[model samples]
Target: MVHKFAIEQGALIEQLPEFIQSHFNMVIDVKADGPCGYHVVAHSLGRGEELEFYSKEYTFSNIHQTLGSIYPTPSEPVGTKHWMSMPSMVEAIANAFESPVFFFSPNLFSIMLPSLLSAQSNSRNIYCISTKYTPFCVLNDEPYEFPAPRYLKNWEKSATKEALGWAQLYSPNFQKAHD
Candidate 1:
């Protein structure tokens, strides 16, 4: 799919723009490694421009303190684990490309509030991507069966304290994290 997006097929070569077609041909004929994702940076529409992007997977896990604190439920329901969806990934990429923005996953705040506080800058816009149901443990009247003991509303205070130290560190911000 990406190849088609970048280059034309063998028989459809004539349909493509000459410059792009020629570039693709030369790249395939000369370049040793197969199709690698790289920015086609050109300063004067020719060569020597600044363009870079990483196509590697960045894995995230809870920090030690967080793990120890949430000992009772090492793993919560849907939202507890480190899972990045397609839209969140796209938003991160867009933010990275557009401005001096700090993209953080929802769980990171509860886990690394102090570190984030320390690294905070005036110009940086911190964007946290989260879903309502995932991070939020709602005991509404909806028809659903939770696997484990869902933390009742009463346990929220202590649990937040134990798992995140959420209120103590971030306070008002912690409220957002909890939500």
Candidate 2:
């Protein structure tokens, strides 16, 4: 669920950090649904249907091969944990599309960064942005937005005493180490 909208210049004057709120007049809010990550990658690469089918097949094959003996048969509701393997999914997407993958998450940066970095290679370019979510003024019932340029630029500025502080500390060294 990717949503695109425009924000009034000073709509969020008192809410978001000045740096994050000022970077863009337009914004995209990607809802953090179960398949949100996959959808983002597929849509970005312009391989929507193909990626979806590949994901389904890949997940089913991996699950059967890796955990078939343990589970024996499928559970009642079906366990989706194996299906949502981010590292494997991202790797598959990158390889299939033959393009760099950029993952930006408001949280889960620390947990995801190491694996993504280790998986990086001369042929594969994987970038991760772990930052705090900024609330770009509410309009009707739509979800919040994260201004990309502002969020990326925030990496270079002073760390805010909020959720983003830890991200700032980790980002520079993490990027340097990985790159």
Candidate 3:
């Protein structure tokens, strides 16, 4: 029902590429405040027709409990409520696609901003997003605080050129892009 509505509204369709025709994967990640874990949906692209959408939902708390109970010695590391379960969820959905497809997650991207920005140590993605004017210091599920200035300085030194390129797109000069 929701998927149909999304299609009607063009929210999900707008994100899809031309090769994709009809199908798409919808993944839903359950929020920590909710009963379910996050979900990820992937769609498969067909040769001439639209893509086929496959949807999957997974619960982190349930998996964590299962893993903990089965393997008492080696439990998965903890993660933010929403982002922690994302990788596996997305992987499973991708396998179902059977063909390459565009992945769409509007809210998910924003929620994972902190981790995405900080994915690589001393990398540029984080540095680019953590600039003086438009810094990202908040995790969606956690509190937001400004890290020490020294920490930022060290980050700038280690960030990669590629990260810098992306950062420039979001800088003040790219006001049109920002809009």
CA-lDDT, candidates in order? 0.24, 0.36, 0.24
Per-candidate total of colliding backbone pairs: 0, 0, 24
Instruction: Give the candidate number with the greatest lDDT.
Output: 2
Tens-place lDDT per residue, model 2, 3-117, is 4435332543323345343433433343443334444444443344233454464445564344333222322423456333444454355444443343434433222222122
TM-score of 1: 0.17
TM-scores of the candidates are: 0.17, 0.32, 0.22
* Residue 38 lDDT, candidate 2, scale 0-100: 46
Error of 2 at 166 (Å): 32
> What is the C-alpha lDDT profile of model 1 across 118-161, one tens digit per residue?
22222222222222212111011111111111222432343323
**Candidate 2, which segments miss by more than 4 Å at Cα?**
3-27, 47-88, 104-131, 134-179
Q: By how many angstroms RMSD does model 1 differ from the true structure?
A: 19.9
